[model samples]
Target chain A: MIRQTLRMARWEVIKLRRRWMPWVFLAFIVLSSQLRLLTEYQMYSNADPGRIAVQAGPANEEGEHSTISISCLDIRDGLVESRLSGIPTEFRQAALQEVESLRDRCPALLGMYDFARTNFLNNATLPGSLSYGINMFGTLGYLFVMILAAMAIGVEYTWGTARQVLAKGCGRGRFLAAKVLGLLAVVGIGHLAVILFMGISSLIITYTMAGTGISTDVMQWLRPGADVVKSMYMMLPYIILGTFFAVLTSSASSGIVISVVFYISESILRWIIGSYLGPDAARILISVNTPLWMASLEFPALNNLSEIYNYLRDFLSTFLPILAYIVVFWGGSFWLFKRRDLKPSTGV
Target chain B: MMASNDLVIKTESLTKRYGDILAVNDLSLEVPRGHVFGLLGPNGSGKTTTMGMLLGLVRPSAGRFSLFGGRKPHREALTRTGAIVEFPSFYPHLTGRDNLAFFQEISGNGDSVELDTLLEKVGLDGRGKDRFQTYSLGMKQRLGLAYVLLGDPDLLILDEPTNGMDPDGMAEVRELIRSLGDGERTVLLSSHLLHEVEQVCDSVAILSHGRLVVQGRVDELVRSLAGETILLRTTDNAKAIEILSKLNWVTDLNSKGESILVSAPTLRSSELSEVLSRSAVYVAEMTLGHVSLEEYYFKITDDANGDTA
Candidate 1:
């Protein structure tokens, strides 16, 4: 049984290698990472290193904003001028507080702005990319693997190849399991490809634009291993969910639609639930806990049983729901695949 | 010639139902080892459904089946069997060689399969490198045949294996199937094509409306159920019927449209002409031929329908 499943997995990889979908995603990620870098480079070059900048635009429109930079030397004068002008009365009090705050830490915003941009640019590099690339990966890996998982299962049904393989004594459950295994293997390879390509491109583009190799003093530099593992761990539910949709509908397009919709809608629901209903209400969802989990990857030394217990509690609280999602989707996939009759292509 | 009590495939009251509709009903069958067994049926006769249940592609609503003596669908039992249910399904983007290689690998026969050899055996060697999508339907069917022949499985279950093939391709497949049933292998072939099954199968089970209508050796069924019919035009139709009716060999005698239809063992048809001549029911025109599976199926269907007129 083990031998049959592994062989199925190997064949899955062979088929995946010949296909265009996963490679297309790899190219998309690698190229888009650079485009993001070039855009960031433009913004970095436009602002002086020690300038305080406010990004202002209509609230409804995002990515259509202009930065109003205030040099460190003119910080007080700019606040005073804005206050004395016919700004709203509410702005006068805010300006007064801001001016006082700046008096004590006038260069703080300048350093923060520079660090934020440079840290992001440094993501294209190795140790930096690991920490930073995981974030990039985290933001997009679900979509990447969601598509991968869907195609891996969905194509088998659509092409009528599932029956072809199953007829050869490969168990239905085993075949589906092998497909999931193969999808995960492809994702691992894709992650590496992203890292390698992102590193090389960022090095070239960052040096050419900013006159130095992408570098960062960011704390994430020390956590490459944790980042990669967590990024993959975090994507499990989405990957399984994608499989659920495909197996349930027996179509790749349906898997992609429902999974993508679930992703987008859940993010929106997280904000809505967090705001109107409260954090406790949002806590049950994957969207809320993923960031919480990502943010709390570090633990203070387990100096005592109390601290260790607390850490474990917090970890389980976040991890258990993800486990539940994996189980449910995984169960759903197997239930549908095993119980229902294998039919010919229902199309995309 | 390879007939035996050792069955390669046996189904005991095996049945399948989809909601209210029965797809395969109480289909108890035995395909003895080392014989090419044909499952003959019309469209929607549950042939594919039966094969699906055997292959574990479809679950049986009731009853059970065994492959190579195991009542359950164990890995070893399934591994010993290879099947094609319905049409040949393959990944369209993959070349023929890759598709076969993938299935062969999963079946645990990866290490030894010479894909090129299988392709050549199926007359698809040169085209094996092309994507499945590029192949014509006949080529695709040929590839499907190659897929099942992998690993030299002990039992081969093929459902309409020659579907969508041209005359040459069909003949090639029929010839291939005939050669494959060479005593060492058990083949359960399903087809609606009567002559094809009659030509290739050593024995057969005929099914209708999800029920086994009849089952026997092809020659035996044709000899008994598919009784020979001779169409004759005589100088005196009344006298011809009177003469043929006296002979025990003449199972049926009818007259219509200027011809006397005589049903009997057509091999003894020479006696028919001789007997008619002596009676002066002189044969003006005569033809003798044995009934094929094609006729027996229709007759059984007619008998089952029962006095529709």
Candidate 2:
């Protein structure tokens, strides 16, 4: 079984290499990340660092000061000017409580504010592109990995290759196992390639646009590395879940539709559950604790300010549920393939 | 009874059902070692479904089958049995060589020389490098045959192996199937073409609506249907016709041209000759017509369907 599965895995890799899916998805990520970095640089270039554009605020007699003004040069400086003490009494209490919560959660950023005062803001910073790319990685990576993984497995049934494989004496469970392993390999290799490409490209862009010296900040380094690993961990469940749907449904279109619907609807579902119910109740959803929850790593404030992560880390750091979801999806797929007859599938 | 090891496939009351539809029902059969066997049935007669069950692509709803003398189907047993059920399906993006190489690897026999030779045998040697999708249907079917021939399995099950082929292609495949029947290898060929099966197979099983209608040696099944008609060209045709018509065993007699066509229910040509010679009407030529597989197939299927005609 192991040998047969390895052979099937090799075949799947060869087939995947022959297709445009992985390379195209990887290229899209690299190109889009670089382009978005360029766009950020263009928008922030030659700005008056001291001028604070307050998009909204309460109307007051002393309008400019009543509306908070923070320098664009540093987020720390801007956040200080955003202190709740200056707010009107009506909104002051609520704002202070939120700020107090954020201050406690993001101790690293707040602690390093004094040291980061000399650094330039936005795209002028050396690690700006890398940070921005890592920020966008989770959501975009989720969509790409889910779509391609579903299509890869689902095409076997659509194209009738699954029947051929089983007819050749490879067991159905082994065949599905090979697909799961093959998907993991593709996901691992594709993600590694995307990270390396984006990292190197961001380095070049930062060196050319800003100066040569890069930030040595621990959080800056730790955040991207953590995000990269977390994004991979976050992607495995989606990949497995996508494949599960593809095998169950036996149609790429159905798999794509099901996965995309789940993805798009998860955030809405999380909101509805969290709003009416509570955050604890909402976290019961695997989707709530997975892509979106993991994607919150992209925004420092979102991860730090939300109490969901706090509650999550209490139970083996919230990995138990995600791991269980992966096992269920993968095991369900294996069972389905093993027991179900290999009918000539036309639609799904 | 033959030893169990000498039988390549044995199914005991094997059955398969899809929802309420019984695709294959209580099909018990034995394909002995070293003969080309034909599994003949019309469309939806469960030919492909039974093959699918044997190949482990479809699960039986009840009963069981053994491959290579084993009591249950397994990967190792199946590795020795190659098959192409229904249409030949392949990865269109890969080259034909790559497709065969993939199956060969999965089969784990890892005989590259055999793979090359099988490709050559299927007349796809030079064309193996072309993408499968680019190949025509005939080329694809040839490649499919090459795929089954890989690893040089002892048993081969082919379902409609000549589907979508021209006459020349069908003849080529028939020859190919016939050639696979060495004294040590068995071939179970499922087809709707009676003539092809008759030309190639030594033994055959006819299936109708998921049940085994009849199974035996090809010649035996044909012989069991009816005796052959004996045609004789005599110098004195009236005398020969009169003598043959008067015989008690001669069921029907017709005179045409300078010959007498005698439907001998059980008598041979020599017996007819004795009567003709005794009647002083010497036969210049005598030919005994063999019952064709086509005729026997229609007769049995019609009988199975309870058709009076």
Candidate 3:
């Protein structure tokens, strides 16, 4: 069985390598990442360093501060500002008042003010380089995982290769297993290639643009080595779930549709449940939280357990439905694929 | 008792239905090993369905079949059986060699020599590198045959193997199939061409409306038809007809431009010659023409309808 699986995997890899589409997708990911890094680097390097101060609070140190400074904006705030500008002024004013009240009660504001004052005097700015790397790696992980899953068995049907394979004495079980392994292998290789490409290019871009003499040790976080590995581990369940759908579906279109629906349904359900019910109920019903719970317990950082727990709780609470989706969709797809007939013609 | 190695295919009351239409009725037939067996049928016959079932592609509504002595489709059975049911399909984007390589891997047969030899046998030697999409229809058909020969299967089941081939391509495929049947391999070839079957097959089964109308050795079946047709050509064509017309055994007597044709149940040329000689008509030539297989096939299939009525 292992020998046969390897043979099938070899053939699948050959097929995938010969095709232009997979390579094109990989190239697109790398190119998009580089482009993003370039744009972000330009924006950061050209900014007036004196204007970029870390705002603390009134009594601490910073004499005066501009509201438009980049530090004042979290990612979510920037996104909301860009997207919700058309909303009526009354609603915006009400939301701003709520934020101000919360900020007034914060004890850390004084410390933030002190840091901002020192940083402004030193002419320092928060680098946007890491943001580009994160965006690129995250986007590739999402796209590659879904694309690989959608095409794994779906390509066989599209090309009529499934009929030829099945006719050669392969049962449904072995065939699906081979397909799942083959797809994961190809996705892995593609992911690794993109990681290498993005890592090297980002290093070059960061060194050339930022002119930061920071050693490799400090730049380790920006490197794709650890992050890509971690992201791939996180994506393993999704890839398996995606492959299940691809095999169960008769065509690529149906597989993609089913995968998207499964992914979306879980998030929607988790939201509805978490919003109306309690976090405990949401945790039980969702999957996103489970991984955070696992990660929190497994990986210890400089932060205390409470901090880790809080992060995990918040992360899992928001993402629980996705995990539920992975399990249910993967299980259902596996069941259907194991029973469906491998027909002689390529329907799609 | 059937010989252990004799029967290559045996189906028991195999039936397949599509909605209200019974595509394959409760049909059963046995194809003996080491013979070029022909499955003769008209359009919409169950030839394709039966082949599909044997190849493990179509599910039989009722009944089952054993391929290469196996009671059901098992790994052993599939390993020893090669089939081309209906139209052959291949990956349009890949080269013929790549396609064959993929099939070889799937079959798990380590014999590369056989692949090369089969490619040569199918007249697709160096062209294996060429993409299948670029191949002509005949080339595709040949490649399809090459695919079946991958594992050197014991039984070769082909459905209308020469469906769209030109005369030359048909002859090539026919010869290849014939060469494969050197008393070691069993070939179940289906075709609507009666003359082609008569030329190559040792045994035949005729199907009409999803039922076996008749089946047996080709020569015996042809010889056993109720009325025999004889074509006669003579110097005195006029005298030959007049003499033949007097015989009560002779039914229909028609004359071509130079020869006369007659259908008779029991009439010999000797008796006809003696009668013609007695009537002062000189018999220059007289011989009995054997009935062609096509006529025999029609006679038996037509008899089936009459018997039902």
- lDDT winner between candidates 1 and 3: 1
Across B214-278, the per-residue lDDT of candidate 2 in tens digits comes to 99999888877556566789878887777777778787776756667677754577887777788
Alpha-carbon runs more than 4 Å astray in model 1? A49-105, A108-114, A117-125, A205-222, A304-307, A346-348, B1-5, B71-73, B110-113, B226-231, B236-259, B263-289, B307-309
Candidate 3 residue pairs in clash (backbone atoms < 3 Å)? A56-A112, A56-A113, A286-A320, A287-A320, A287-A323, A288-A319, A288-A320, A289-A316
Model 2 CA lDDT for position A261: 84
Best by DockQ: 1
Native-referenced DockQ of model 1: 0.60
What are the candidates' individual DockQ scores?
0.60, 0.51, 0.39
Full-model lDDT for every candidate: 0.78, 0.76, 0.68
Choose 1 or 2, whichever is better by TM-score: 1
Assess candidate 2 and give its lDDT: 0.76
Taking the tens digit of each residue's C-alpha lDDT, what string does model 3 give over A36-102?
Answer: 6555445444443222222222332666632323223332244435533554564556545544554
Candidate 1 chain A minimal-lDDT segment of 10 residues? A51-60
Instruction: Give the best candidate by TM-score.
Output: 1
lDDT of 1 by residue, B100-214 (tens): 8888888776443478888999999999889999998899889999888888888999989999999999999999999999977999999888889989999999887788878
Which RMSD values do the candidates have, in order?
A: 8.2, 9.4, 10.2
Q: In angstroms, how far off is B267's CA in candidate 2?
A: 3.9
lDDT, candidate 3, at A6: 78
